[model samples]
Target: MNIPNLLSTMRLILSPTIIWLFLRDQTLMGYIIFGLAALTDILDGFIARKYNVRTKLGTVLDPLADKVLALSVLFTLAMKEIIPYWIPGILAVKEMIMVAGGLFLWNKGVVIPANIFGKVATASTYAAVLGSYVDRTIGLYGLILTVALSIVALFSYGRIFFKEKV
Candidate 1:
């Protein structure tokens, strides 16, 4: 695997550890690990784009890692009563649809890259997750924004998929 792909793999590995830490009531440790995993997400994308070492595997793995990390953390936060269950519930549905759509496109040898909407939605998701640690109200607004943006991204991806599939 290339460096970017390796970093994505690291994020995938760290996600469950972050969830475990949260489950054990180690919020601070979980946040630190979450930050590291988020850093890997940024670094991998930057390195892949800058070095032009993008691969089919990296394309799939990068976003899959991001989705897994974000969804796992959101679910853990909801389980801890730090955030409402509906927030993760909506996100889970959105992500599931996205995953299904992505797989369909992948089967047809099409890989749609992340657009600006998706990037903002992901950043908003992380912010929302972190905000829940401060104030539930702040987190709620952030999550609302995240959900709206995620839906927009979902539609955008769907549009791209149909365009490419044709």
Candidate 2:
């Protein structure tokens, strides 16, 4: 297993730990788990490039893990009302659209690479979620950053999709 892929796998493994800790009302511990998980995300990409050990499985697993984690965090936030109810609704729509695009591309044998915008969006989201978990002091800024990144990421992704396969 490549180092980057290994780090991604660890993030996947930590997702459940974060959920468990958060559900148990252990906010501080949950933040710790989330921090470590987020760190793994940062390390994975770095190691992937530095060691030049990228793989197809990593391509698939990494995004799926991100979606899973995002959904989990969003669910918790919605329940806590830290985010508006429609936030999840819109996010779900976005994910579904992306998944459909990915499936279409995969079926056509076009290996649509993971764009950097998507990575920025994911990192921003994790930061916002973790910020909310820790304290609302920085959470507002985190959310602001997340919204900016998501807009750029999704817009860029849409541009690529429309340009290449539309």
Predictions in order: lDDT: 0.90, 0.76
lDDT of 1 by residue, 66-150 (tens): 9999999998888998878898899899888888888988898888888988999988988887787778899889999999999
Q: Give each model's clash number.
A: 0, 0
> In candidate 2, which residue ranges exceed 4 Å CA deviation?
none
Deviation in angstroms for 13 in model 2?
2.2
Model 2 poorest 10 in a row by lDDT: 83-92
Return the TM-score for candidate 1, rounded to 2 decimals.
0.96
lDDT per residue as tens, model 2, 95-153:
78888988887777665667889888888788888777667657656766776677777
